[model samples]
Target: MDDDHDDFVGCDTWDEMTAWLGESLPDIPAGVTIDFGPKDLHIGDEPLDDEFDDTDPIEALCAQIVVLKHGRYLVRRSHVVMEATNYLDHDASSATPNLWFDDDPTGDCTAGSIYVDDAGLAAEICVTWLRAESGLPDPTEFGFDISEATHLPGLPGTDAGWSLDDFLRRLGH
Candidate 1:
């Protein structure tokens, strides 16, 4: 197993984040759908009607996660989807939908949110969340045993095993 901490962290802008995702994730297929709500804000599905009107911040954030995960990607891609919504009026945030790979308790993964005013802050928040949710030895630690998680097969950019198509397909049309 590679102990390299080569995992990219800390992005200063949405563009940078996207670029990072592109590099990190394997190639997405043509039929695959990435539903980012709105023309300019193409990250997730349609925003909730009362998202802006809602007083609570967490509620709005949760709503956005639903829309963002609509997009699909390969498992080995390691790509995460992010969206910008008017719900919080913040610069940016992130959300994950599926948390676990299998029935194994140790295989648990999380689909949550990280809100911040800037990319730098957002990256920090993501690291913190990863540390807290995974219960790893350290927050900075990467590459843990994901044997419980389903194995992803295939090459980058192609619709191979565990591709975005596979993920969305599992969700059902």
Candidate 2:
């Protein structure tokens, strides 16, 4: 993994995540406060999809923010991992952070693992994943950029040298 902590300097905390969502997305319906601390966020009266039926309930929450490099624009999404605790142990936990590119003509989705010392670090880790997945125009040319972005203090080593662009290229993108 990259092991560089510099990229995660400014990230939202649990509370800030809630506030940021309120300020960004349209107001959630009544009784749907941006709280994912206790009960999991359910879609409706229906049970979760069968694919997610075996998923572990979330013990923590994180926020997803999408930023466009060339424009002063950003959008936020808060997602609760229903299987976070399965990867957690006494001193740490792992989260699978996913990025949905709604605007990508090719319908690309990016994701990776993030380790957290505690639940409080979830948002920061999520932000790190976002930066790595944004595909921004930077010195590292997206490929080398993401290849050097993974950094979790207490988790197992990740395939940081892995590059999304290369994967896409191999897949004929």
What's the TM-score of every candidate structure?
Answer: 0.22, 0.21
Q: Per-residue lDDT of 1-173 in model 2, one digit per residue for the tens? A: 12221121122243443333233322211111111221233434255565665344332233332221121112222233322121122221122233333442211112323322222333344434434444333212111111112336888864434344432343233
Candidate 1, residues 19-38: lDDT per residue as tens digits? 44344223332222222211
Worst 10 residues of 2 by lDDT: 139-148
RMSD of every prediction: 17.6, 19.2
- The runs of at least 3 residues in candidate 2 whose Cα sits more than 4 Å from the true structure, single-residue gaps closed, are 1-15, 18-44, 47-81, 92-110, 116-122, 127-173
Candidate 1 lDDT for residue 165: 34
